[model samples]
Target: MLLILLGVLVLHLIILVLLLVSTAANAWTIGSTGSTDLWYKCLTTNGGYHCLPASNEDWIQAVQALMVLSVLFCFFSLIAFLYQLFRLVKGGRFFFTAVFQILASLFVMCGAIIYTVMSPDRDVSSSFGYAYVLAWVAFPLSLISGLIYIILRKRE
Candidate 1:
């Protein structure tokens, strides 16, 4: 039982870290000339790189907000999980934690989808970056963690 709980905690922490990295890293889209992310558009020129704040598009702002919200909710779920570990009844499920985590997953998925569909930089030379892949990876892991929480029951 202890080992199982520890594994779940580790998984949740990994998901949290992934979310943070995906949200903050400026490598969502990469091209020959530069890269663009949620926060910045970096262009490489004359052996140097120049960065500018991302465009003020409402959709980009929405993605930013969703990513931030996802991080917050995932962090909250972790805290809730720890609290419930000690306070919950033996048979109780971590429903609140599960809900928060699930919401976090949904937010990540939505944000990534919006970015993929709405992004205007569809040049043939560019490709999606690792950070974008991380967002997608985090989505499933977070969802799985939430499902695990829902299925878990405290055992003494």
Candidate 2:
């Protein structure tokens, strides 16, 4: 039981790292030109290519904020999980850990949903490549980890 809980905690941490990296890469790509800092000609003039400047900076900022929130939640959840493990050994219930886990999952879900609904079509189909997929993948793993935490119990 302990090992399983530990493994889930590790998975949650991995998902958090992946989410942070994906967000940073995406922000860089959206904020810069293909190879130069100059405004991407393709983005500013034409709309066929993926390396286009964002149509809405506000949307980008929102996504970035959500990503940051999600990362924070994941980090806190990790700490809570570790603390819960120690408490479990001492025969304490994991009320707080479970709360943190659920909250983290909710934040990830919100971030993922916002990206899915508000993201420009061109960015996902053309610009982001694997980065977009990675963000979506992190969502489920984080949610799974939270669910595991909710179900976890110390065995005598």
Candidate 3:
């Protein structure tokens, strides 16, 4: 059971990393450039041609900052959870660690939500892809991990 929990935790971390990387890529409009090219040629609807504007370094930098902070929180939460797993005792440490982990998850979720709500449609490049889906995926996993931490008990 412990191993299973550890595996889940590791998987959660991996998804977090993927989320961070994908957000960074999205912020910089990486593959979106080629996507824009294809979109312009293949899909020309009533809403003009779908071509991404030139990269905006400033916007990218701002998004990167948010991503960096989210990543940091995830990393810290992972470490704290692992530590609590090892040092699981009926004490204040357990509660504190669990609280921190949950807060970290909340922070990541909030940042992602903000990005989604505030981000312009053109920033999305193509309106269809796995990147957007991945963000949604990470959101739930992180939330689950936080919940797990809250319910977790030390079986000594």
Candidate 4:
């Protein structure tokens, strides 16, 4: 039981780190000369990089908000899990933690999908970058961790 609990905690922490990186790193889309992220669009200049504020398009704003919300909810779920671990009854389940985590996963999925469909398509050389991939990867892991929380029972 102790080992199982430790594993779950570690998994939750990893997911949290992934979410933070995916949200903050400026590399959602990458091309030979530049990269774009939720916050900024950076292009290589003659000898340096020029970064401009991200476009004001509605979809980009939506993605930004969703990613922020996902991080918030995931962090909240981790706190809930720790609190419940000490306060919950022996047979109680981590329902609140599970629900928050599931919501976080959904937010991540929605954000990624919006970015995929709405990102500019003119650049044939551009490709999704590591931060974007990390967001997609975090989605399933978060969902699985939420399910585990739902099934976990407190034991002595």
Candidate 5:
């Protein structure tokens, strides 16, 4: 039981970290000379790297909002999980945590899909970057974690 609890905690933590990294890392789209993220578009020039605020496109803004919300919800879910772990009675389910986590995963999925559909096709050289991949990766993990939380009953 201890090992199972620890494993769930670790998985939750991993999802949270992945959400943070995917939200903050400026590598959603990578081009030959630059990269673009939710907040900034950065490029490398002659011995210098420059960054500028992301465009005001509605899709980009939506993605930004969704990603931020995902991180917030995931973090909140972790806190809720910890709180419930100690306070809940034996046989109680972590429903609150599961709901928050599932919502976080949905947010991530929506944000990534919006970015993929709306991002400009800069050129043949440009491609989705590691951070984009991470966002995609986190979505399923979060979903799975949420399901696990739903099924996990507090044990004495």
Candidate 6:
């Protein structure tokens, strides 16, 4: 039981870290000359690199907000889980944690999907980057973790 709880904790932590990196890393879109992310577009010029703010598109802003919310909710879920772990009696389920985690997964999914479909096509030479892939990877991990939390029960 202890091992199982520890594993779950580790899994939650991993999801949290992945979400943070996915949201913050400036590599959602990559090109031969530069890269772009939620916050900035960086281009390598002849002698130096230049950066500009991301587009003002509503969908892009929505994606950015969702991603930030996902990270916040996931972090809060972890804190709640730890708190409940100590306060709850044996056989109690981590429902609140599960709910928050599931919501986080949903937010990530929505953000990624929006970015994929609504992104500007001007950068025809660009391709999706590692951070974008990480967002997708984190989604499943977060969903699985939420499901595990729903099924898990406190035990002595």
Which pairs of residues collide in candidate 1? none
Q: How high is the lDDT of residue 156 in model 2?
A: 62
lDDT of 4 by residue, 1-156 (tens): 999999999999999999999999998999988999999999998989999999999999999999999999999999999999999999999999999999999999999999999998338799999999999999999999999999999999
lDDT of 6 by residue, 58-107 (tens): 99899999999999999999999999999989899999999999999999
The positional error of residue 8 in candidate 6, measured at the CA in angstroms, is 0.4
Work out the TM-score per prediction: 0.98, 0.69, 0.62, 0.98, 0.97, 0.96
**What local lDDT score does residue 110 receive in model 1, on the 0 to 100 scale?**
98
lDDT of 6 at 112: 98
- Candidate 3 Cα errors over 4 Å, as ranges: 26-62, 90-94, 121-125
lDDT of 1 by residue, 21-106 (tens): 99999899999999999999999999999999999999999999999999999999999999999999989999999999999999
Clash pairs of candidate 3? none
Model 3 over residues 3-100: C-alpha lDDT tens digits? 86777678767866766655544332124343321112223457554555434545434444555665676777777777777777753234554565
Clashing pairs in 5: none
Compared with the true structure, all predictions reach lDDT values of: 0.97, 0.62, 0.55, 0.97, 0.95, 0.94
* Steric clash pairs (candidate 6): none
Cα deviation of 2, candidate 3, in Å: 2.2
Over 1-156, each residue of candidate 2 has an lDDT whose tens digit, in order, gives: 767766886787788788777665633234233321112223333534455554455655566677777777778878887776766664555666666656666665676666666654434334543555666778778777777776677666
Tell me which of candidates 2 and 6 scores higher on TM-score.
6
Global fold similarity of model 3 (TM-score): 0.62
